[model samples]
Target chain A: MIEQYLLHLFIIACVYAILAMSLNLAVGFTGLLNLGHVAFYAIGAYTSALLAVGLGVPFWGGMLAGGCMAALFGYLLSFPTVRLKGDYLVLGTLGFTIIVEAVLKNWASLTRGPLGIAGIPKPRLLGLSLSPLPAYALLALAAALLTYWLLSLVVASPFGRTLKAIRDDEVAAGALGKDTFRAKAKALALSAFLAGVAGALYAHYITFIDPSSFSITETILIFSMVLVGGTASLLGSVAGAALLVLLPEPLRFLPIPSDIVGGMRQAIYALLLVLVILKRPQGLLGEDTLRDAWARARRRRKGA
Target chain B: MDILPQLIMNGLIAGSVYALMAAGFSLMYGLQRFMNVAHGATYLVGAFAAYACARLAGMPLALSFAIAVLVATGLGVAINQLVYVPLQRQKEKDRALLLASFGVFLLVEAIILMVFGADVKSFGLPVRKGMDVLGAVVTPVQLVIILAAPLVFLGLWLFLYRTRTGTALRAAADNEAIARTMGVNVRAMTTLTTALGSALAGVAGILVALEQNLEHSMGLPAVLKGLTAAIIGGIGNVPAAILGGYLLGLAENLGIWYLPSGYKDAIAFVILILFLLVRPQGFFGTRRREEAGG
Candidate 1:
């Protein structure tokens, strides 16, 4: 029983790790303070769920469609709003998330209102259903590892350097002849794609999907995971996800009332977020990504 | 009774409350570049404070309102001191400040939920007959709101234009470094700005609670509407924010005439996105130099 519980926790951690890493690309790498990252996650989950449950599509096909749909939305959203800098950009992203949630809740015909879609079929490999906790855990683990590897490669590529440049100073990056807008759009699309995949995995694993699961709180949770783990560090994303996923689990064993537990967990996260941002903005596992980048740029100028 | 007049009156009432919120929000945004997500929490605190004072402590209605505004102002200033000040001192990134504010918002919200349960609370104000205004029925409390909003705006305008502290705040908003060099206490000005802004939010919250009901989750929607109004008016422009608030109120109310009432919440977001994409400088805001990126 203990092992089974551990596996369940592990799967949740893996799902959150993918979310954190995807958010890290926009927030950590590209300097986009996207408060609406979970919108794309919802988009992906709904797309996949509808396709698999309604159209009888395979899991792989649904996942691909989910990623593409979310990416399309990312590109469409970023094309116009990417030029906005700082807090304005943050508001723009936040507006997107609120709209997405409103649509999901109000569009009864499509999302079934608040009732939510259920009985999502499990993933099947070679006509063999991966329904057991252990099999699903392996699937989630593989997806998380793949996401990390792919994201690491992206960050190490020339595109990654350009993103860092833009993050540090968009004007300087522009002066150097980089298409900063296109780069930001691409980054947003890629980030959305990854988040969508994570959403797909979550849908299949949980076997239930609802609009409530993709609220602003979930976005904040993923964001906190990124910040607490260490922005701009793939490993930090994994560790942060694991830590947070496990942090509240021990509280279940406590004699506290179930109703208060949810609020307590959120309070703990809020405290951690405030403390981390104030005391250790570099986070626990990685260097201060944006500040260090700015410092490095300053040092380079001084050297010149 | 003409439905048009009723809708227009209803819209104006809603607009007046949003104007209060937007004006304060715009004032703070003008000075501090970061959006304080905790602004909503402060509003909630104010509403709940009034609720607690009136229902639990059995304070007089007027006294409870005053106490609520004071508490909100204190909470706002405290948040700035505890969260934003330390990060500013460290020269932390804007994202950090934003995240910290979000954290504070969540923390305060959870605390409010814990203390006041998740159930919605009401002020239990005594019911009175609705007065007819221009062929439309208006509640006494709503008339008070309508009358009070303009008075508050005028008071704020006079304070900003005629008072010494207000001038210092304007100076800081124009250029913080220059304001500091010119003997303006930048720190004190920020604290004052937060207090005033939060007090406005508090008033808006109380008025809203008196009109409707109070829920812990009301903060986010209130903040969003205020934000939409501020952005539509042009960020940092007080007069424009007020105008935007009225405009948003009208648009939202009239919009439900054509579409489902459920889409009422979405109208603000749509307007926000449209403004962000088409004219981010908004109705009165000058195009910022930084926005002109390559």
Candidate 2:
């Protein structure tokens, strides 16, 4: 039973690592800062859940379909808000996130509303069930490693250089004969795909999926993980995810009341985020620093 | 009972609240160009502060509300002094500011949960009867909400148009660099905007709490609606925010007549998406400014 508990914790960490890595690709590498990323995760989870439960699709197929569906949505969403900058872009993505939640909650026929889709079948591997503790843990670990490997490859590629250039300075990148908009849109799609796969893994591992599980609360937690690990670093994503998952464990032994425990946890994460952003804007592994950005803002102000 | 008139009345009352919230929220958006999501926390603080006064302390309703508004404004200024001002001193980027604001939101939410618990609370005031208004049943609290909203807006209008500080605030919002060149204290204006915005949000919280049940979770949704309305009217445009708020409230209420009532929130988001896609500048914002902002 103790081993099972540890494996469960490991599996949850692996899931968040995948999510954080994917978000890093967009935020740290591509500079989209798309707050609506969790909407894709929710879509992926719900899509996989529905496929397996309602249509009898296999796990691998449902997972791929979920990734593709989320990618499609992410790509489509980029076109309309491609011209919006900063706060406007954030607002656009936020609108999408809220709409996704509204659909998940109100469309009772498709999503089963707030009750969420249940009875998700566990994945089978090598003609064997993955429901056992060790098997599921191995599956989660493999998926996370595969995501890291592939995302690192993408980040190290020549196209990745173009993405960084755009993120650093879109006009300069455009002047360098790069199609920054298309690159950003593609990066968003890839990020969404990975996040969706993570969502699928979560759905299968937990064997239950709900709208509430993917709310902005989850997004903020994911954001904290990414920030703690430092943005734009694949290894950092894993470290951040694992660290945060374990961070709350010690609190369980404390004599705090049950009512304020959740609040305490949230406060911890929030405080960490605030400290990290204020003191280390680039994160634990990333390159951007608040001081440097401040200098740039000063220069721009003087120029203006 | 006439469904249309009743919906319209509901819409007007809700619009008033939304406008009040939007005006406060948009002030920061215009002047400082940061997503101060803690505005939601301020709204929560306003409602809960009133709860603390009226329900917990047994203060008279008018005094409780007055104190709530004051406490909320103080909370807003506190957030400014602690978070916004420091970030500005560092010349922080928009993303950093946004993240910090989210941090404030989370921190405040935790505090609220700790102090108030998760259970819902209210003033538990004596029940009042509804008055007939063009075939619509309107309660006194809601009527006061409807009336109070515009009076506050008028007050805000007067402050912006008739006051020198308001002109300086507008200048800073229009172009921070230019405002500075013209000898405007951009930091001071930003701080002032934060205070005004929080005050507006505080009033909105009190009015809405009087009409609806107060919960710790109430802040995010109310501020979100205010955000939608602000975006609809144009993020930085104050008067336009009022129009946007009314439009959202009306759209949300009347939309349930044709679509399922559960889709009311969806309708607001749909409008937001449409506005974002087609007219990113919104109703009052200039097209040129959108490109410039990008």
Candidate 3:
């Protein structure tokens, strides 16, 4: 029983790790403060769940479709708002999330409203279904590892360097002949794709998908995970995801009423977020990337 | 009565409250340059304080309102000092401030939920008879909202234009560094801005609670609507925010006349996106070439 609980915890941690890593790519690496990331996650979950349940598509195909759909949305959304600075872009993403939520809740014919879609079948690899806890955990772990590997490769590549450049000083990057707009769009798309995959995995594992799961609160949670882990650090993302996912488990073991447990968990996260941002904006494992970037930009401005 | 006129009246009533919220929000954002997500929590606390005063403490309505405003104003200043001041001192990025404010909002909301439970609370005031104006019926409370909103705007306008502190606030808004050089107490002005802004939010909260019902989650929607208005009118422009609020209210109400009423909330977001894409600086705001380079 203990092993099963630990495995369950591990699976959740892995899923959140994937989410945090993806969000870190846009927010931490590319400097896109996206607040509507959960919209893509919702799209991915709904797409994969609908395709598999509605059209009998297999898990892999459904997940791919979900990722592609979310990527498309990310790319499209980036076009109009790519020129917006800071808080305006954040508001734009926020508006997008609200619109997506509104559509999901109101478009009952398509999404079934708040009733949600249920009974998502687990994935099968080579006719061996991963239904058991251990197998599911392994699959989640594999997915997380693949995400980490691919993301690391992207970060190591010239494309990743360009993204960082754009993040640090868009004007300077542009002066150096880099297409900052295209780079930002690509980063957003990649981030959305990964978030979609995580969403798909979560849907299949839980065998349920709902609008409530993709609320702004979920986006904020993923964001906080990235911050806690340390921006621009892959290991930091993993550590943050693990710590946060495990942090609330002790609450469950406590004798407190279940009703207030959720609120307390949220309160804890809020406190942690405020303390971290105020005292250590670089995050626990972060290397002062954002501050360094800002300082560099200011220095460049002074020089010019 | 024609449904159109009634809807317009209803829209105006709602718009007034939204305008009040947007004015305060815009003032803070214009000067501080950070999106204070905790502003919504101030609204929630205001209503809760009013509820506590009138219902739990059995205070009179006027006294309760005064107490609620004071509570909200104090909370706003406290949040500024506790959460934002330290971050500003650290020279944290705008995104960090934004995220921290989000955290503050969540923390406040969680505390409210723990203390008040998830149940909806009403002001528990006696219902008044509906009065007709130009064939549209409105309750006395709503009429107060409609009448009071313009007065609030006038008051704000006068305060900003006629008062010494208001000039300091505006100077700070224009350029904080220059204002400081000019001997404006930037800290005091900011505190005053927060106090006034939060007081407006408190007024809006009480009015909204009296008109509808109070729930912990109402903050998000209130903030979102006020934000939409602020963005539409221009982020930092006070008068424009008021106009934007009315426009949003009218658009939502009129649009719902044709579409499903459930889509009313979505209208603000759609407008926000449209404004961001087509004309981000908004009607009253001048376009900055530097900002456009991003």
User: What are the TM-scores, per candidate, against the unseen true structure?
Assistant: 0.95, 0.94, 0.95
Query: What lDDT tens digits, residue by residue, belong to model 1 across residues B112-223?
Result: 8878878888888888899998988999999999999999999999999999999999999989999999999988898889999999999998998898888888988888
The lDDT values for all models are: 0.89, 0.85, 0.88
Question: In model 3, what lDDT does residue B197 have?
Answer: 92
In order, what fnat does every candidate score? 0.61, 0.71, 0.72
DockQ of each: 0.62, 0.63, 0.68
lDDT of 3 by residue, A34-55 (tens): 8878999899999999999998
Clashes of each: 0, 1, 0
Task: Rank by lDDT, highest first.
Answer: 1, 3, 2
Q: List the residue pairs that clash in candidate 1.
A: none
Q: Rank all candidate structures by their DockQ, best first, as comma-separated numbers.
A: 3, 2, 1
Residue A289 CA displacement from its true place in model 2, Å: 8.0
Tens digit of per-residue lDDT, candidate 2, span A94-144: 778888998999889999999998899999877899999899999999999
Candidate 2 true-interface contact recovery: 0.71
- In candidate 3, what are the lDDT values of residues B152-173, reduced to their tens digit? 8999999999999889899999
Better of 1 and 3 by DockQ: 3
Model 3 interface CAPRI class:
medium
TM-score for chain A, candidates 1 onward in order: 0.94, 0.92, 0.94
- Runs with alpha carbons beyond 4 Å of true place in candidate 1: A288-304, B291-294
Off by over 4 Å in 3: A289-304, B291-293
